[model samples]
Target: MNLKDTAARAAILGTLHKAIGDELKAAKRELGEGLRAAKQETGTQKISVSLDEGQDIGTASLVQPKAEAAVTDAEKFTAWVIENFKSEVERKFVTSVKPGFQKKLLDQITAAGVAEWADPETGVIHDVPGVEMQGRAAYTRMTVPDAGKQAIAQAWQSGALAHVVLPELTAGGAE
Candidate 1:
């Protein structure tokens, strides 16, 4: 090849390299911005729970909870976990895979019976209320305050807790 042709080819290659480099840098910047926006719009965190029978009852979660009312010190920090679990479970079954997969596992438990002290989705023993003799006893603590625990129980039993738990925590804010 002649010197002039070799030089011309080198210049064209250099120009192409610079153009590609600029595109790569711009794409990286756009990706960074998109990540930031996503972080702001929908932050995410992991949650774990164990409520199986003949096993320990525990939950682990990382959330930024506001106001002691949102969760008292006596309660487990996994309140957000319960909330999210309910939401994910009740999202509805679809023909496609993915979201419905979790629903399939959770839907094994169905609401049933009179007292309703169990979780319909996971069949776990969720919050149940203390029946204050219903007609005679002034105060009883078999489950929770008079009818307080029962309300939670009924909700879990009938899937009502899904609506209540999610909005309360999401509005109060979470990770």
Candidate 2:
């Protein structure tokens, strides 16, 4: 209402805005560092393929193969991997990362003060962020509760997984 009062209010408001901005920046910086560290430390392994001992896709297989049993097993396994690889790899990747993501989400949300997120989604989580509740559910793909897991799953699907499309391997030998 008065000049001095208005000036004082503006100064306080500006300082408050600056402080809030500074705090938010610090929060983001810390979070980024944390994520980097987690990426290094956790380093979730992708679902890798191992040839069955009897199948002979690798060094050992070369030595042991060509028997009727070996050939049949190899053929069956080749067919199986060919048919189910996309889904199998996808499933392994999802399963491996789900727990980590969920734990991260639980920690982040708890720290962020939104601890009441239901134990499980009443609806669906999507690999696509901001797409949950309809369309394609995404985060559920990796089965992780963390937003990072959701982001990673989406990236994995659209990035490497998209490129690889399908993978093949053979196995052989005795064990």
Candidate 3:
């Protein structure tokens, strides 16, 4: 009700929120493994778990795995792209080609995330130089129906929480 009390409550709630988030990640990992195993054994790609059978709840489903790529060396990648794929490079010169713009290696690599980069002329698949690809396993994706989301929002908006916005706390205590 008071400033000090609200600050204390918010501090405690913040800690609890972080702990809950860590636990949720671990739980999700376990659930994803189970989902993957089930899909493998049943030869099914689409697997979902109902949050609650009798209640209107969210559902968690196993989605396809994706790959992640990151450019570790920007200069090396830029040189490689210029030598290998000239068309992918963008040149911006003010006076001459001496101080021209750098290649868009990061942009091109990011746009080509989780996909193969092929040579334009040769049509041969080539790995982007200085870019390392990491394969991410299929993870469980959770989805809440629109109706459930609306109900949850309404409930929260109508509750005591509506007026309990966390204020900017001072270093040692409430201002």
Candidate 4:
């Protein structure tokens, strides 16, 4: 309203603006110093931690040597099976007719040993020496039971099952 009032308000506004600017500058300087100090401290400190102490540092991972060994062993076992028991394995895995039919046929053959045979179509009854039935041998597939699988898995997960020791080497030192 008046010249004096206007001049006084302008001076106060200018001072307030300068104070805010100075405060901002000080805050920025403090932040920069804090960051620099943190960086320097981190650089100076070498984080040497031994995981063997069983410390709960953070989220841990289960590294089972037995699991890896089991996989290797499984590969070996598969190879052995393929090499040594190829025919047996094939017979075991082969899918064919139902067992009931084969069993019934075998039972009939056994019962009709050295008996007379009658041809259904010709109606000719003839004495036979023996009934010889020849076919591929049937074998039931051998599967690892669920309980066995669970046991193997448990063995794989158990620390006592297998242990692999890695050689320790010094870092940033002469070999």
Candidate 5:
């Protein structure tokens, strides 16, 4: 490249860099001012006042307590049910047998999208459904439907499940 081209490119880059730096500084100043305004509006600053009787009220400061996170009874019950029944549901799906009697015992692997059948007497593989001559299978993950949520909710309301209670905190002060 020529010297003129190089100089022009450098000048453009320098102008862009300076513009970006100035914008960043302006943004930081605006953010600091906004934060200060918000703090003052929220009563984070201390204030002192003098009464008519020449009595001075000491510096009064506002103290805001951070809210504590809590879990509800429904959430706890849902967690408990999932922990207890998740494995059982997965096992049932994995070992599920197709209805009706066939000459061969077929185990349907839904995730693999294939029905694996083997003869009991000869112990030979036979009749894979949806398998091509090239032996390629289309696999799909199985998802279990959440059909028990209503039942669980009903059971909880009927007192079949234990209820959970969370502690509540309140702030009190004299005016």
Candidate 6:
């Protein structure tokens, strides 16, 4: 295709991709409601559905109230970690304490679940300093067939989208 045609196609595809994304988001929201209803009807926190029974086209699973830990106040949390867990400090960060503590705390929090941890020296469980639980939602995660994976990879390797310089669109055709 010529440059003009390619650029036009890129613009159209961009718009279409965005529309498809919005539709997917709406569909997922509706599907989440349906998943919640299925959970309520079945009385199970974990639910799975197979779209094409024998063909294995797609699958979605839900784990209700999934909690992830997020660090809210890094400075206060780093100070708390340094004061409480001195030995767990990593020295490579910034020739100082805050960054190291933050990295260590993040690693520990990820190992433990949802802002929780065990004192390495004492063995008592406690919440990691400066962290809070976020995203405790009953969202369904999907897995679909990799039917276009090869084609997509080939397109990338072929640089099919490398030089798609789209012209700037102006409001009201202002030059």
Top-lDDT structure, candidate number? 6
Per-residue CA lDDT of model 6 for 78-168, tens digit only, reads: 6666767676455574423456556665667765666877767798777666787676667788765574445445545776634321111
Candidate 4, after superposition: displacement of residue 108 in Å? 93
- Model 2's lDDT to the true fold? 0.36
lDDT of 6: 0.61
The stretch of ten residues in a row with the least summed lDDT in candidate 1 is: 132-141
TM-score of each: 0.25, 0.25, 0.48, 0.22, 0.24, 0.49
| Candidate 4 vs candidate 5, lDDT winner | 4
Clashes of 2: 14
Each model's lDDT comes to: 0.39, 0.36, 0.59, 0.40, 0.39, 0.61
Candidate 4 structure quality by residue, lDDT tens digits, 1-175: 8999999998877765665556556554654455445445773212221223332222212111211101123344334444533542334474332345334433544455523344455866544332343333222122345654565456557643343211111121112
Model 5 / residue 8 / CA error / Å: 0.7
Tell me the deviation in Å of residue 158 in model 5.
56
Ranking by lDDT: 6, 3, 4, 1, 5, 2
**RMSD (CA, angstroms), candidate 5:** 28.6
Q: Per-prediction count of colliding residue pairs?
A: 4, 14, 0, 0, 0, 0
Candidate 2 vs candidate 5: the lDDT winner is 5
Q: Model 4 — TM-score against the truth?
A: 0.22
TM-score of 5: 0.24
For candidate 1, lDDT tens digit of each residue in 1-175? 8999999998877765665556556554654455445445775232222222222233222233321111122123233333535443322352222345333322322222222235456767644222111222111112234355455565578765555344534442332
Clashing pairs in 4: none
lDDT tens digits by residue: candidate 3, 1-175: 9999999999988876765566567677878788788888985545433322244546678887555566566676667767765765666752111222222333344468743466455977766666766666676787888876765566556663333222212222332
Superpose all Cα atoms of candidate 1 onto the true structure and report the RMSD in Å to 1 decimal. 27.8
Clashing pairs in 3: none
Best candidate per TM-score, number?
6
Off by over 4 Å in 1: 44-175
